[model samples]
Target chain A: MRRVVITGQGTINALGRNVAETLQAMRDGRCGIGDLEFQDVERLSIRIGAQIKGYEPEDSFNRQQIALYDRFTQFTLLAAREAIGQSGLSFSGELATRSGVILGTSGGGMNTLDENYRSVYADGKNRVHPFVVPKLMNNAAASHVSMEWNLKGPSFTVASACASSNHAMGQAMQMIRTGMADVMITGGSEAMLCFGGIKAWEGLRVMSKDACRPFSANRNGMVQGEGAAVFVFEDYERARTRGADILAEVVGFSMTSDAADIVMPSKQGASRAIAGAMQDARLNPEDVAYVNAHGTGTTANDKTECAAVADAFGHHADDLMISSTKSMHGHLIGGTGAVELLACIMALREGVIAPTIGYEEPDPECALDVVPNVARDVKVNAVLSNAFAFGGLNAVLALRAA
Target chain B: MSDSIKDRVIAILAEQAMLEPGDVSMDQSLEDLGIDSLGLVESIFAIEEAFDVSVPFNANDPTEGDFDISSVKAIIEAVTGLVATQAA
Candidate 1:
């Protein structure tokens, strides 16, 4: 089996548009949650969201392409551009055939759906937009990315809710390890801050009215966020021969499902997923230093996740430096895992753990360090990124410093 | 207009599209704002619940239900028309 490593990474979120800016924002302990103002959410009691500001679709695609794609696809393309550019590899000839794209998204083309719905129903118009199907499908982002980048091998989208991206990455690593593909572009994107989307979340009643405060005693609930994160994964020897800048090694990945509940999370499922990843990497729990928690800031998720960590690592749970980058970026739903993975790679490379901001009071149920409010500089060797989604989907990835 | 009728229209818009009072106007077109076709159908259900009246639908063309449903005025017109015919 061949080993896989992340040669390049790119991200766009409430914090920044690229890896450098995003990492800097995380280090500076910035919170991206703010009042939601998308021209239609004036009545909803919950208004705050981590929206990506100043992004234009025209900047990433041509006029014809823009008409075919939605905001979520635009985000995927922009993040893919950054990842491929950073990787310094071109898909010119056979490379294009061998390379593939895998992306995850939950709110695929919701914004487009919102627009077309208004045109047909509210306006009493019979004519629908031309790109409605292409825009609204959940796989549209992956399809757009593959077509834009000319990736022909095994391109598809994964939708495991919040765990979608991590599951996509895990599948990409397996494909390479099993000699299925030579190279893969994997990540996730979301653009669900539209008025209709926000209203849908309001019914769930898990949104934080003030701000997202994960692992804090005063935690309310998660603040919705939007953006994309992508990574270039190549075989280790292939990357080394090309003199590519290796960011981190994809040592192991694991996924598990808790057949327990629809919305409620389970510690057993989360713990098993983490342990399974560690076993896959052939590393003990002690080898893992930093943990990027799911940490959705909800009353149940935070406490349940903390218990899972403690159950997985035993005594090391108290000492392990865990933090939820979601506290900074808010929950990106499907894109959350991919962005959190970028934070893991950064933590492993820079030897600094990003803090879980908005952690005011410590929840007695969540007793982990959580790297609370301030970034910590430490010599980290390996990191774990955890993503647990609704309906009991759980995925975990283990990365080591290259 | 009866207070119940006005309240029913407002309530339908608020519940179906998650709109607030300031964001919605009786004369405003729903298309100009953001409520889509799915939103319109959902709003119809909300209207039924609010006014204890079931708006008639054209079973032949399901798509017709979504067209021209922009403002509360348009919705009221559609619903009142249906109610009058049903009474007759």
Candidate 2:
């Protein structure tokens, strides 16, 4: 089997607009979550979210381009441009034919949907935008990304709620390993910080009005966030032959379903994914030095995740560092795992463990070393990123230092 | 007045456990009655709704919760105490 390596990474999240800025924000433990300023903010119960404030669409896209690009699609194109630029690969011939774009997004075009809905219902307009269907499709981001970069192979989108990105990347890695593609543009993007998005989540009673304090005892719930993170995954041999700058190695991935509940997380199911990733990577429990947890700060998620970690790693659970950057970036939902992978890459590349900010009190149930409150400078060999979404779907990705 | 809290809580627990109310002993833990984490949380929600009182039961650390649930008896006692306090 061929080995897959990440050659480039880029992001435009509430934390920052690029990899460097995002990593710096993580190191500083800055909270990007704040008051969400959008239309009809006063009508919602939860007005706070991690929004990319002051973003001008015109700055990135022209008027004609903006008409077709939804907020989520715009995020995808911006992140993809940076990632492909860093990858230094101008695809043509077989590379272009084999390479493809696979992205994860729950809300493909929330801004578009909300706008069209208001135009038709609230404003009493008879007709809405003609391209509403194309703009609002879940695969719009992936399709535009492929068209923009000329990636003509195996392009698609994954929509397993929060686990979407990890699942999408896992599939991309497998395609490369199986010699289907030498290069893949893979990751996820989400822009759900809108009135309709928040209004829908308000019914679930899971949105936090003020903050996201994952793994903290006093944590209320997860706060919504909007952004995208895209990566360049290439075959290790090709990258090495071309003398490319490898960021990290994608070693293992596994996904599992609880088959028990729709909303509440399952400890056994989560444990299986974690243990399965280690097994697939041919790694012992001790080989993992860090974990980017799916710690959503909700009592059900935090406790269930900690229990799953303990069950999978046993004694090592006490020693290995684990943290939830959701505390800082808020929960990006479908795009969360893609952005959280940045924390893992930084950990392996720079030996910096991003902290779970806003941790005021500790609960024994979540007794792992969460690297709370501040970043830590520690050498890490291998790390795991956990994405446990609603509906009991869990995906775990394991990566090693390049 | 507080005596009714125990019966109501036990009934809620029995429903969650999918067992008869009379079969729910005060000594049996929720786990002993086959009540999983989901059941426990749902039971808490139901109890809170039925009693019209907030139960400080942390799903993360049930043992350390403000409302006790060591056993069916403890949960009943906790609810009775809460009801008495609310009445006062």
How do the predictions measure up, each by TM-score? 0.82, 0.85
Could you give candidate 2's per-residue lDDT for residues A229-276 as a string of tens digits? 999999999999999999999999999999988889999999999999
lDDT of 1 by residue, A107-171 (tens): 88888998888778888999987778987898888887788788888889999999999999999
After TM-score superposition, the amount by which residue B20's alpha carbon in candidate 2 deviates from its true location, in angstroms, is 16
What fraction of the native alpha-carbon contacts across the interface, defined at 8 angstroms, is recovered by model 2? 0.09
- Which regions of candidate 1 are displaced past 4 Å? B1-88
- Interface RMSD, all candidates in order, equals 16.8, 4.8
In model 2 chain A, the worst 10-residue window by lDDT is A201-210
lDDT of each: 0.85, 0.91
Across the candidates, what are chain A's individual TM-scores? Answer: 0.98, 0.99
Per-residue error for A256 in candidate 2, Å, reads 0.8
Q: Give candidate 1's error at residue A240 in angstroms.
A: 1.0
Once fitted onto the true fold, the runs of candidate 2 whose alpha carbons sit more than 4 angstroms away are B1-88
